[model samples]
Target: MGKKLLVLGASGNTGQHLVKQALERDHHVTALVRDPAKIEIKHDKLSVEKCDVFNKEEMRPHLENAEVVLSCLGFPLQRKEPVPYYLQVAQVLSETMHEFGKRRVVFMHSWYTHPESRARCRGFFLKNFFLPYVIGQSLNGMRLSEEYLDSTDHLDYTCIQPAHLLDGPVTDKKFILNETDSCIADAAQEINRADVARYMLDVIDDESSYRKIRAIGVGVDVTDKAILTDDNHSYVPNCPIRISRADVARYMLDVIDDEGSYRKIRAMGIEGDDSYMAVIMEQIDEFKKVIFRN
Candidate 1:
């Protein structure tokens, strides 16, 4: 049976995919949004709850039937909204979940938030500048939100960290899962928002992921199969690659269970420094196999 869900930030880029994919998988979803119109998709199994996270009364009723909570809440980079929205949402959700006795919660975070983990910010410009400068303001809230999530004792929470998100189709590359410390390789690593959402919902029923932080990134194995260069050239096949939303959504919903993923902060990506053209060669072999089989 599909689980009931209370999804915050369902209107955002990644949240939309969560909503869509969850419903597609027949999970009952109650999307908590400030405006119902923001949710462009509609389905019989999906319900849109109009409420602000700050309004406890308005939000309480939506929490009544939900078995799990998924939060992708965060403000846009262009607007630095005061009031520490991440922290506030964390507090509210914590209280609400405790009140309803719901335990499992999945949160959207970033690869940059846990620098102390295995993730290393490669490149001098990214480490010395972009990490600290371009996203400094937003990082504060992510850091605080993570602290709150980690400190809370009542909920079984998982903070999902994905590298840069881009719009594209999903590919055949398997997501590289690692501990928070080991998952991220470069500041340039990117994945699709759909892929992130796919992963978040895929683990909704996973009792093992409780109280863990996970980082998801593109794998070095499939980089060449999908990425195109500036001149429409495919980059040398073995580079770290970006993923597609369609592929992510498909994979997450289709993934089978694995006990190794339980209660651990797993990083998903390829290992080593130079991953050139290997993915291309693999794909060619796969194509050849298909042709020969026919």
Candidate 2:
């Protein structure tokens, strides 16, 4: 059966792609965007609602009874101060989802503010001059937002923390997912926004993806079928994943469970530094057959 969803930040770069795909897949989509008429999504399966996320009352009607919610919201890049808007929206959304008994959420986040994990891929500049400015001027509110979510026991949430996002063409390569750092690699890695949408939806109902955070890399297609394992550490390479492999594999039977690394591996059909992440979940399903076959 097709499920219904309330997608926040539908006007955003990633959210736009996600909303389109959801409608294409025949899911009933309610887009809570700041502007209703401004959205170019011309799908019959889609509906748009105008909302200011900070206004909890205004957004409540939109959030009510939605099966799942994906938050693709963020602050502008030029801002030299804290991003209070994001924190307010996230906190309210969390409570709203909890109150409505709709706990599924996939949140977009950056690795900069997530000091808890080691995915901090330091660029030459961020490590040098920009770090102080970033911490002092930009990162505080996001970190607080994360802290709020961390403390919120209300909903089942998943936060996707991405590395330095550089704009480039999609390589149609596969994207990797694991709490482990082993998958991290190459080319000023930024996930194709479309691909991030793909992962968010596919994993939305998977129990393992609930309350889980994944750090991914810009990927290249790997058809060799070689499975790499990083036993050195779990989730983020150095930082251990709180869960075990038995749990991850059980949640999404299609993925290859690398207990050695405690990370989930799947090919997004994207190959190269720039990736389209378009192959869908075909590769992972094939691996599942090999691994889980009796």
lDDT to native, each model: 0.70, 0.62
In model 1, where is the ten-residue run with the lowest total lDDT? 222-231
Give one digit per residue, the lDDT tens place, for model 2 in 76-124.
4322556676678788898776767767788877655654343354444
Q: Write the per-residue lDDT of candidate 1 for residues 119-150, one digit (tens) a residue.
A: 26764445665555455446667778878888
Query: Candidate 2: what lDDT?
Result: 0.62
Question: TM-scores for all candidates?
Answer: 0.71, 0.66
In candidate 2, residue 192 scores what lDDT? 74
Misplaced by over 4 Å in model 1 are 78-83, 115-119, 170-172, 186-188, 221-294
Best by TM-score: 1
